[model samples]
Target: MHYRRFGKTNLWLSVFSLGTMRCLAGESNAEENIQHAIANGINHLETARSYGKSEPYLGNILKKLPLPREQLTITTKLPPTPDSQVMDQWIDESLERLQLDYLDCLAIHGINTWEHLTWVESPRGCMQAIQDALAEGRIRHLGFSTHAPLEVILAAIQTNLFEFINLHYYYVFQRHAPAVALANQKDMGVFIISPADKGGRLYTPPAKLVELCYPFSPLELNYRFLLSDRRITTLSVGPANPQELDAPLAVADQDGSLTPQEIEVFSRLETQAETALGTDRCSQCYQCLPCPEMINIPEVLRLRNLAVAYDMTDYGTYRYGMFENAGHWFAGVKGNRCTSCGDCLPRCPEQLDIPGLLADTHQRLNGSPRRRLWG
Candidate 1:
């Protein structure tokens, strides 16, 4: 594994940092995975209080081991709720859950809008709570994670309040590239979350994406693509299993940059993919599982992305066909049946706008004259 300094913090962090989302589900031996990662020299372990028992699970594992707290960097997040009292309680809860006296880094989870940032900066706001935590020695540093548009990220950075910022980035979703560069210029630590979705999805892309990525794993190519830019300080992996961890670590260990041929391949693949898929971010992970509407979420999104990326409707008819009875499936609570209740939004490992995306897809696939549905 390779390590790099995390911007102005002057702390060395593993290029491949372990994200705690998958670890929370209790699918694997939490203790073993934590020990194995630390044993393998992964010094950075990121978790969130909202990650469904992740903090508590990690807390249990750590309490059993003799690992030095100083040697490990534990990062967690404060929920983006407007309730200051709730935020404070959650912070204390997170500390207790992680069995730590203080967090190395505590970020404001999911700063999705500029208004949210403004609210955070206001009096008695979340940022103030973070400052209070820092004063009380409960948190060492402050940061935030975002899935908003690049402009929102830029706006947040310009506020000059964050020590670091986590955002989606990879070879395929280069929209955030300029923002990453700007963050580096500002000397802020840049953490790239889920390169597999941001990068890997494009690497092993669908048939159309494969034609775009050419000779790379769409995965390796995406990693190489991100590594080509030195501004990225750490790349967080949501490894469902140990095998998922190995691929990126292997790539990080390699010295030197992408070969000219690889670079050319990336360019060609990117263009081909854009020509084929339209949007650059969807990874088709199929995690929006058991679609309530039988709408084939991943497939429909894939076709939509292709239509937008490639500017061709070659797959539209087939995509619409899949959604033929989507309403029936959704009616009983299956696919595009989101009620805007905001439950699944936070549960999503990808942090996607589940409701909004579903609504848009429903309209596009079932709203036209040829496919109109009576409400």
Candidate 2:
């Protein structure tokens, strides 16, 4: 139940916020679980306009609960639309669905490309429309959620228009940490999304990682790792059912400090990882980037690490399949595209055999060529 200054908002948000992305699942005690989480000091409830039925479901639960309006912090992301009128309609609909007078925060959901940024800046765009809502007292703060490239994300943060940001940054995907630090420097709130599930699916963590993070579940380690950094404001925990809240609730009660023993464990884990994955293992340093094949080298290699080191070959294969479909959001090839011209090898500080790793990664994770997500 510990709270921290949510950047420039100055709101003392609980380190863990209740995310409403998966609340509509058929769980009998879903509402009661939400009430319990609220009772345990989770004041922030975050949702998006496009998260299926989550907004309405949470609205019904909040209406039935005894909590007052002033005691709760509600946030919802307005789906990005090029048409200003449609954006207006979506914002109004979100307000109606949430049954709230004013949103504590409203974000432009999935601002994932430079084109999206351009659309937001266009005359008939959501930015002005949302700001109009802001001036009318419909929303208290303006921000955005993005799954864009690191450079694109940095550009958005540099704009200085957002009061906060919701982005992905976890133990396995620390590449976004520099952008997060920039947000901190700009005095903007940073809400990390889906740390457990998207953060390497730690909820059902591989046995090796579990042993590596001794004394803490992989989930706890991931949660604590993000919280240990002072720059991060809150982590969005999207619980699908009542049972899903147990470990997260326990994590929330923790002090969020990494003890000496934990640090030693992490160090040992890194060493073990080097030993297991060998010299060819990708460190995801991005130094060997700018691949000519439009391939996301680090991404494909990390998938290989999942298979070889973490023993998550099935998950790795699934994620590798996602590359062809991820498109702009995660632009990459499935490692087999490497022509082996020795382009990336000389640039690598670790002298990694990039082409060989790519071949192995493709072989390990490209089984049956699963269809892309949203294809």
Which candidate has the top score in TM-score? 2
**Native-to-model Cα distance after best TM-score fit, residue 31 in candidate 1, in Å:** 2.5
Q: What are the runs in model 1 whose C-alpha is more than 4 Å off?
A: 198-204, 207-215, 271-375
Tens digits of per-residue lDDT, candidate 1, 218-288, equal 57766776666668878887766666666676687753577998878867765666555334345666576
lDDT of 2 by residue, 40-95 (tens): 89888898876777778777777887867878888998757788888888888988
What is the lDDT for 173 in model 2?
78
lDDT of 1 at 264: 86
lDDT minimum window of 10 residues, candidate 1: 326-335
Look at candidate 2 and tell me the lDDT of residue 184: 92
Best candidate, lDDT? 2
Model 2 TM-score relative to the real fold:
0.92
